[model samples]
Target: MRNFEKNIKNKAYAFQLDPMPDSFDKVMDALEKKKKRRFIFWLWILIPGFLIAGGGLLINQMYSSANAQVQAQSLKASHLLTVLFKENKQGLVHEDKYALTETTHTTTPENKMNNRPTSETQSLASKNNQPVFIKESSNQSAEFNNRNEKSFVQIEEKTNMTQVPSREKWTPIIFSNPYFVTFPTHSSNPVYSRTQIPFTKSTLPVIKSNSHQTGRWSIGIYSDLGVSKNIFINNKDSAGFGYTNARQLTDKFLFSYSAGIQFRYSPVKWLAIETGIGFTHYESNQLLSNAGFSWTTSGNNNDPDTALTLSSVDPQSAFGPYEYQNVYDYISIPIKVYYQKKWNWTGIEAGGGIIFDLPVNTHSYVADENSNMSYLRHEVKTSRLNVFGIQASANIHLVFHIKKFGLFAGPTFKYRMNSMFDKNYITRQHNYFIGGEMGLRYHF
Candidate 1:
């Protein structure tokens, strides 16, 4: 029984049972009853408190910095304006001597009006005892009066000179921004008042004349996705394999692309001379002809009825599946004198030009299948250079203008005067072609 008690004591010690705090059981009971209440308490109290504090601190910092910057900028601008004002004041005082002289003259006029002694002077002149002294003083006063009159005339002349409009001031401001105008000073103002009558009192002239058309320059880059037909230009009587190949190589529905720059001169509102230099690339491929040899082997001796005969003959290559491609890249200089009839935001122009088409790179690639057993089964390719030619264009241009800039797009029917190929093989000349051009223009 003592051992059993000791064992129970050991178990109790292992567990170490202690009494709970006063609120621990109650808090545990509350937590177990509503798990969401604890989360709501923490989220509503701690989270919102932290966010509000952080946001307030950030806003305070930004407002402080912005206010400091604004204050500094305002101080700097005020200082600059003050300096400009002082400089202008000093310049006006130095340039107009009347500013100082007028102040003195105004004070003198006030003094003269207040100190009039005409009756006393007349009584002194009438007294016989002081007649000589009065006469001498009167003569002195008369001389002084004559001198004052001359001085008054001189001051009036100076005022008139100072009143003339200052070209230096107006010229600089006009050149800076001629579009805007500032109101002139009133005649009652103390500073620069007399000079305001000319520019302000006179009504500003109406700008009734139409805007003059200025010179224009434009450049355009375009990728054309169009079909073209490449027809053969050869001598009718050429008796060669090359002529036959050329005729067979011509194809329809080829690819073409062009790039150009156009310059325009506008002599009138609705008329201009448009000209440009441009480059064009035309490409096409076709199956022309194939040349090969054909031969048959002799019959074997196993059959007694077969007769042995030896036959020999010559053979020539014929037209078959030979691939060919022609690429014509030309530089064209076009001069077009056009008339533009302007509508609200668009214009139409129809013009023709004699374009000097300089053949830059004209190459025709020809390839034939190799059927020989000794060599690899590959196609044999050959390239040839071509001669240059001239082309003419008659186009109706449609212009879409936004302000003074415009986009010109038009369909042009082009005709070449000569074939863009070498004359040594096939000498026939192609006389015409058709294409279009789109460009951009800017007017000054």
Candidate 2:
């Protein structure tokens, strides 16, 4: 039995030393190739998924912007039509004029007592201080003579008396037939012609134009909420000693908020320039798989490199689920130009601009796998870290107008145009953000 076991052991040792068959080698190679192919397949799927989602978001934003413009224009047109109708309804209408005539016959007591035919004339003046002449017919005078009694006849012309020409010479005229006179009046008031009128008064209603149609200055308060991420660009020249071997850092989105006061100057109905200062809070969380040395100090000091040491020396300690939390507070100023289309009670606006970020404070911390805080560092010196900087952004907004006030809300996209860190830093940082902003605007 010992000899048989020895033989079996020898056989096993020989088998272990022998080379694998070609088919088995080919199968192993194929498995490795399949693994790579599966990885690439999944990568392709994920990339397109992200792209599709981003495209969908862009499409939605565009659709909403266009819809808002349409609605605003419709509202404006309706309001304009209503105003025009009201003005027309309140307009004044003029009426045409008609001529009038009057006749009168009178017998005075003196004329009757004289028992003799006598002709008497009386002169009268109108409110305009114009003299009027009245004449009696000769036939009436003959009748009075035949009766041996005195009589008088008066005929009044009531055509706009002011329109009648003023004659320096008086001429006598006869009318065989008796005539009646009628005077034209408006609401019991005598009407006068343009020649006699000293002044004219208007009785039309006054309509005020819409104030929103004119351009003006506006002031507003704005607030934003969003997600932000940082991208690191590695530089061999600026990467410090330990950072050369430092594992790649990965970051995730965190909450960001900003609030500010803005001033806008609109020179035309479609264009405006805006500027403002605001307070911003930005937070980001990063993960480092490898442990590294960080600069620290024993006491309160301004020196950035006064002390440097590794937290742990053991290689096992280097394999860590280390977490870094960064919080930055900034005072930001923005300059922008906007193009707007407004309707009666609404408007849509699009704008692009640069923002200047002035850092007020920066706080950084590290935590271990057990969620224990390892270090609290203020102003940790990192390569190429720009505490204050500038960035570019674009925005689209929908506005609801109420008299002199406007309420607005929109989506804003920001891109870092310059590196946030200096050239001496090992890693350069560029930050981008997507956010929603809301605000109230007052016009002057």
Per-residue lDDT value at 97 in model 1: 21
Query: Over the stretch 75-140, how does candidate 2's per-residue lDDT look in tens digits?
Result: 223211110111123332112211111213233322433343225432222222121222232222
lDDT for model 1: 0.38
- Any runs in candidate 1 off by more than 4 Å, and if so which? 1-225, 235-250, 291-320, 365-387, 422-426, 431-433
lDDT of 1 by residue, 1-444 (tens): 699999999898789656644357557765874575455445435543554455445433333223223323322222111101011212232221211111111122212322332222211110111111111111112111223222110011111111111111110010010111111111121111111222222222111111132234444443222345655543442433343334444455554656677666767655667667788777665443333421111122222222211110111212323334567778867777776776433568887777776767765532211121111112212222334566666777776544345556667666666655444333443534555555556666
Which portions of model 2 show Cα errors greater than 4 Å? 1-215, 235-249, 288-319, 365-378, 381-387
Q: Model 2, poorest ten-residue lDDT window?
A: 168-177
How many collisions per candidate? 3, 12
Please report how far candidate 2 places residue 28 from its true position, in Å: 44
